[model samples]
Target chain A: MGEAIVITSGKGGVGKTTTTANLGTALALAGKRVCLVDTDIGLRNLDVVMGLENRIIYDLVDVVQGRCTVQKALVKDKRFDDKLYLLPAAQTSDKTAVTPEQMKKLIHELKQDYDYILIDCPAGIEQGYRNAVAGADGAIVVTTPEVSAVRDADRIIGLLEKEENVRSPRLIINRIRGHMVKNGDMLDIDEIVMHLSIDLLGIIADDENVIKASNNGEPIVLDPNSKASIAYRNIARRILGESVPLQSLEEEQKGVFAKIKKFFGMR
Target chain B: MNRQKQQYVTIKGTKDGLTLHLDDTCSYHDLVMELEEKLSVNQTNEPDGPLVAVHLKVGNRYLTPEQEEEIRTLIRTKKNLVVESIDSNVITKEEALGWKRKTEIVSVSKIVRSGQILHVKGDLLLIGDVNPGGTVIAGGNIFILGALRGIAHAGYYGNKEAVIAASVMKPMQLRISDIMSRSPDYKSEERNEMECAYIDDNNQIVVDRLQLLTHLRPHLTRLERRL
Candidate 1:
């Protein structure tokens, strides 16, 4: 059976949906059959992130509530050539429309076909969180370096640890600004990991291109030269048990002298 | 002593001290006479014994100041006797209830998450961090062994004497009784030391280092001794 991973963070706007989209696309590009499941229900955004919003005729709630079959609800990504699919969440219905048992049953069926099923969990440790984590075998908790975000991430990690199926959730430090870290204004990765005490899966630095890619309905992982895309591809490899060295975020912006030298072709 | 005089006054020994039960139905003269007789006999029997503090219980009756003074004078006549307290039936009942409330303590060892609230009916002893957006309300004092970045309302039930102590006390808002104080916007680098919050003489919430808490309430050391 394929591994079902839940992407969750207790606080909102910390890039849980973005991570799910990029990681799912990257995994598919690595020759894996990936199905991205959006479990946010009323606050669905994964469909828009994947550029599959128009193709979602039947959603997760419809499949769970017996309104449609899983195959009918699954939307194939045209860019991936049948390797990537998305099961979108219902825009009208809330999280309570589907129970944990129904989610577990749906995931069980999907596991028979897909290589990886990534659930985009909603924020907060409430009913939505329970439903998203109910069927997952592993979890990825994303968080920013801010104190509020780290505090909520700690709570999400605590909850994930208590689940029988979720094997020790990994941490993804998102939106890290190296300049701020160097200036002692922002928390470092070591400090966050020390506070949370979870395994580090990947770190995606703050990149303006990520926002542009999201606005254009494309994950950064689709672009080879984007720094954030490179980070997401590395994260996908790390998830597949590859020993990939972390990319240094500090060197992305070249100094003015180096830019001038390159412009003048000085050798 | 006559059977009626014996019924008017009764003396009992306890672990902490002695208890004197005075009946309101009897005449004041008889009550004083019987109490003096018991004290004289008790002093003669144990002349060199350790001093035993006496607590008087006047059932369903209010004693005039003169009558109360007479009882105190009679008990003090003996060298081995000392009056600890004078209580009426109403005060004794209230004290029993107060003791029951004071003995209750809620101990939680889990980290209080965001959007989670914990309300304790008595003193609270927490061994985990209270994250931002979390709230802890205690009727009495609150003791936290970890960082307190959330709202902690000690003395929730209007107990101004209650205190809140934490190892790393950078709370979003600290409330003692009805007074509330929010932490400054800038973070302090010296959070390694423990800090305590309590009501000051002006009835405002004041936070100081844990060691200096004794200066605010001198009886805190005595209470810690009992613990």
Candidate 2:
């Protein structure tokens, strides 16, 4: 049986897609056979982020409706085709086209061939969210350090716990600005972790390289030097059952102060 | 005469327990007579006395609340009686109100997500974090063993004495009774230090390190202490 992981966050626009893309790439790069299925039916972005938008002849809805087999709809990623695949969401239809039982059946069919199945959950705690998480063995909630994002993460965690079969969802704190945290101007790592109270996966420091990489349809995990890339790599490693220690706040603050003195002229 | 009265009862298993729906339209006294008659038949079938119970059903006929109470009192005295809704003669506001008085305490084992409000009347204990988008309003003291990082209101019914305690206390908003504080300016180490928040002498909610409350309390004695 393959392990299915759902990447979800209650609030929208908090890096669920970005985390899915980068983590899938990172996991595939680690040689695990991974299939990333986008459950956001109407607004399909996982395909675009994975740079396989042009190759999608069939989508998740077709597979769920039995119009096409899951193997026929599966899009092989050229860069990591041997290890990573994409089950793109249908842009024409809404989330109602797929039921939770159908999604579970689809995942179960893929289980014999694949080792890891990652479902990119839709935003909000509606029917779509339920369908995406229904078949997953576990879940990872993505959130930013902002109060709004953290609140949504908490709510998603609540929903996951209430689900009959879901294991406790873990947390991913993304797009964090280590500098603002040092100045006490923004919510810090401890605060976010304390608030969400899920198992700490790892923290991804805010990096402009991630934006540039996304613009080129490349994931930040490809860049070995970027802090966010390293963090994502660590997260990918943790998913593989490796215990990796997280970077300390003091180390993060050092860069914050250095940037302030150099960029803002604070002596 | 008592043995004759016990003969009319009937029994069947239900989700709650065994139910006995009496013959329809029978008067309360007539239903009692039939219940006794049924019970005598059951007693003869099983010589080893299995505790048999009786219930009466009136098909859509509304009886007075007093009649329902009399039946309830009668059944409660007997062993293993479950007067289900189908058999219940009538329901009164007073009886419904009694069920509402029963309180429950639920421990949130994990993060309470955003857009969800947990309104608990009794002591609320949370094992996990309270994220920012979530709100926890309790009528009693709130204890977050992990973290209280969301919007929290303790002693919600204007009770001045309620305390909100958390291991990591970086809440987005904190309120105790009428006092509301929403400045994200406080800075403390990320160590597992406990914090307690309450209103102080000047009527403003004050949050201090739980360990330093001894030194801080003497200076703010005018502030009321909520137990």
Candidate 3:
């Protein structure tokens, strides 16, 4: 059976959804039959990010409540063809509408057909979080280098460690800026790993292309030239148990002039 | 008269004193009337008895000053009766004795998360880290095998000699009896040595290495004897 992994971060706006979209696409590019399930319920956005929002006639709630079959609710990504699928969350229903048992049953059904099931969990440690993690075999905790995000990530890691099925949830340090870390203005990957005490899965640098790709309803992993795309591919490889060395973020500096511009609050 | 109404005001004689148990659900008017009737019956039964102090036990109810005064006046009306003191019947004298005799240590092996409060009647021993925003309160001593990062209050019921011992003593607040000490801001270090905190001779909370705590062991032993 395929593994179900939950992508969660306890705090909001810390790149959980973005990480889910990119990682799902990266795994699909690697020729794995992947299913991206959005467990955010009322705040669903995964379908929009995958450019499958318009094609969604049935959703996760419809499948769970038996209004539609799991196969009917699964929306195949146009770009990935049949390789990647999106099970969009119900935008009108809240998290309470779905129970953890229902999510477990849904994930069990998806696991039979897909090689990888990635659950995009909603922010916060409530019912939505429980539903997302109910059937996952592993968890990927995403966090920014900021103190608040790291603190919440620590709590999430602590929770995942306590789960019966989750075995040592991996950490993803997102939104890293090499110049900020070099200037001692932001926490580096090493410092964050030391504080959180979790194995580092991968690090994605702060790239404007990520935002542009999201706005265009395209995952950055599809754009092979983007820095985030390469980083996401490395993460997917690492997840598949490949020993890939980390990319050197320090080597791609923006020069002294750029630093001076950044210092003066200019983009 | 209802048997339940009659049982509302129970009069019992003990070796130390006489106890008057007032029912928790009885109205104030009914309590006063029942108490007066009981006292009059006792007075007529023993006409030439000496004055006896009566302890009023109101079960889990706070008595107003006016109600207390009314009860005291009713007791004084009987020439051979006097108001000793007002106490709650929620916990009986035997129950208090049982608590004092309790030397059991409660042990917990899970991480105490935020917004969780663990209160133990006797000594408490925890085998996991107490996270921030959590609280650990004990009537006796507290011993943490892991990091004590949360608030720990030992000797919450006023046992001045109770101590708090932890492997890593970086708690937000350490309290012993009435004295409380906030943890000082310090750099994180591998604290291989355990520490013990207790109220010193100067009436201030002081933390010392576990090895040095032997000097205070005799005092703690004496306090246990008193208990």
What DockQ does each candidate score versus the true complex, computed on alpha carbons? 0.20, 0.44, 0.08
Writing each residue's lDDT as its tens digit, candidate 3 over B33-97 gives 87877777765566477778888889787676787898899888876678898986455466667
Measured against the true structure, the TM-scores of the candidates, in listed sequence, are 0.69, 0.64, 0.69
Error of 1 at A135 (Å): 2.7
Judged by lDDT relative to the true structure, which candidate is superior, 1 or 3? 1
Cα lDDT tens digits for candidate 3, A82-138: 889999999999999999999999999899999999999999999999999998999
How many angstroms is residue B181 displaced in model 3 relative to the true structure, after the best TM-score fit?
Answer: 3.5
Per-residue lDDT of candidate 1, residues A176-220 (tens digit): 998999999999999888667679999999999998999888999
Error of 3 at A4 (Å): 1.1
Stretches of candidate 2 exceeding 4 Å from the true structure = A247-267, B1-113, B117-227
Score candidate 1 by TM-score against the native: 0.69
lDDT of 3 at A238: 98
Candidate 3 lDDT (Cα, 0 to 1): 0.86
Ranking by DockQ: 2, 1, 3
lDDT of 1 by residue, B34-75 (tens): 777766665567678887798999988777778788788878
